[model samples]
Target chain A: MGNSFFTPLSWNDTGFILTGVLNTVTISLVAIIVGTLLGLAVGFIRAEANRFTNILLGGVLDALRSVPLIIQLILFSTYVGAIGHPLDPFVTGSIVLSLYSMAFMSEVFRGGFESVHHSMATAARSLGMSYWQTVAYIRLPIGLRAVFPSWLGVALSVIKDSALVSVIGYMELLRTSEQLISRTQQPLEILIGVGLFYFIVSYPLSLYGRYIERKMAI
Target chain B: MEYEFHWIIVFQKLPQLLNGAFVTLHVSVLSMLIGITIAVLLAIMKMSKARIVSLPATLWVEIARNTPALFQIYMAYFGLGAFGIHLSPYAAVLSALVFVNAGYLTETFRGGFQAIPKTQYSASKSLGMNSVQIYRYIILPQMFRRIYHPMTNQFVWSILMSSLGILVGMDELSGETQRLQSLSFRTLEFFIVAAVMYFLITKLVLFSAALIARRVFRGDL
Candidate 1:
């Protein structure tokens, strides 16, 4: 190990870094897609359900939100193994990360759904639209459009939080860089690269979110 | 799928784990305080008319907001080490959390400040109030009230992120849980308790924040 104590980062490590980036992107996509579907469903239910149902669903989502994602990942992986179902890190990471993202996404979705004025729904009903028709035609399109910024915000965070899956040993960018840092012992260069990669991915999306938010405000 | 429970072993080490929780709370709260201080300054600078003053502020805010918190902590702990500035794990985590906190809070504070109309400032001046008196009596209070919820969310985020302390071998709650679980081989039980503790900690913070907001905002929030 000491033989390469000061090895400079070389192109040889690019494939390693690329793998990490791909893993990070892959897991993030899975979580965001799965989480959005779940959150969309749960958020809609919460919006339409009775007060008691809302409370129950809200409490479960609250637990997901309140705990740190790392702990959830660790607890989840260990619990699953203890229960005699030892899955791979990627699978475990996806499950926990998706649920975690879903917690925040549901809130965004709920707010989006509720942001539509009661007047809009009444207007649709007066036009003789059915309940689902009013929802699909008016509320879904308008409310989802209204929440583009928030949805982007949560999705971007899930991308960032995907790094925590490394705790469960699914090597994403940060963890991949970590392994490289140990091998190369060039923490500064590797870490800056990792930070830059995340910044590159996140910054433009954030700008887009803001731009749309401004557009929608008008 | 049959598994025997070992919660008793975890319960036996509760005090040790609680101490770690205190450290987690301590680091995050301290980071939040320092972060808010730096963020306020950064916000002011970003809003300055001069490019020279605002450029660095903008860079700092953007980098902080865009990068992952895990990256920030590692950069603090290990990245700075490459420059021969060896810091303790606690110091590194604190500095990183403070950096990100300041970054995000700068935007929040800036937004809060902008939300206050310039007319309010001019009207206060017309009321014969000096700048300090106007800020103290009118502008500052309202600005804080506007940003209070966002600030609370930042605090909670900091709390949750401080769990990254485990990675660098800082004996925060997660790290301590990891150590204890390794020793006792009760990983699931220990982590489950830690999860509960985190849930409780965040809930307590939100609960008290609500109480404080109720009093501070006087039903406004």
Candidate 2:
């Protein structure tokens, strides 16, 4: 077992593990882009609409927020499969990840938009700017800046969560590590490598998030 | 052609699902109790003036927060087996969760600690109280009160994150659901019910926390 630990895994095995990293990044990027767009729309609607509409939307988002993402991923995929139109693991996993992210992202954006003072919008309107012009020129920029740190936090979380797609047989980093462990019988080294990979992916984003928060605080 | 949903299969299995929910709650609550105690110490250490006292705490929180909980669980359950220090699935999941909970709540707790004015500590010290007395009488109550809402939020997070235990072969709620669904082949119905159960559990936590907060902090800001 001692020598087995020291035995180097072949370049082929290392390449296979790195493939999982690619899938992880792809899934996270697609989810964040799609989720952010959808979330922005929902946040805008929730922030700008009347009280009744706000309450209606809030309830739906809250439901999505309350349910754990693991359940959502499993339910959505299995439901699709049961209906006789089986989704590719990547497709279904992406769909659920985006939907899960959308809930938190919309909440972040809504809070950001609300942080913009009402007087700013009122003054813009008094200056004869249309609602859309005010939103485009003034509100959105301020809100996005305000929400950047929180948005980064959510994005980091997405990368971490992408690991869960492994449960659905999507073959991300954690699943790849499991495969490597079985083949090599070196779970300790393999899993430590797995943790290092995640830390590499997430720590910079976390540092950047802290940097943004500090920068914005001024 | 219409597809029929046989939710009856799920209903018939309600007892087992409820047991799974109980397991979920048990793990989450136990981990929180153990984790929060360690978190308090870590929080204090983070606030220490000496790097010797603080750096290790900082490192633990950074690693735990940045990485996925799944990785921790895998490392505990499968990784440690290589070193011949094997743990049961439940023990592995629980320990990993405790590690995570402490990491997150350490920050929350430190923030709570920092939010207090230094004058309070000086005031208590000037009253001839010892450091232990100062913390017990002055710091802890305020820290707990100030951070109560965030603590509740973390509690809910712990509850949800505990679902990762399923991957390690722990028969928690998600694991039970997977087991039952595989047997019944009523995948959709079982998962839908499981989702509802999870939703209700989290909502129940929120609702009860609010109730307790109202009672505990009555007439206080």
Clashes of 2: 0
Model 1 TM-score relative to the real fold = 0.98
Clashing pairs in 2: none
RMSD, one per candidate, in order: 1.3, 2.4
| Predicted structure with the largest TM-score when compared to the true one | 1
Q: Fnat of candidate 1, please? A: 0.91
Query: Which portions of model 1 miss their true places by more than 4 Å?
Result: A1-6
Q: Write the per-residue lDDT of candidate 2 for residues A1-218, one digit (tens) a residue.
A: 56655445677786888898888889999999989999999998889999999988888888888878888888888778777888999999999999889999999999989999999999999999999999998899999899999999998999998999987889888888888877777788888888998898899889989998988788
Cα shift from native, residue A41, model 1 (Å): 0.5
Look at candidate 2 and tell me the lDDT of residue A105. Answer: 98
Chain B TM-scores per candidate, in order, are 0.98, 0.93
Q: Against the true structure, what is each candidate's TM-score?
A: 0.98, 0.95
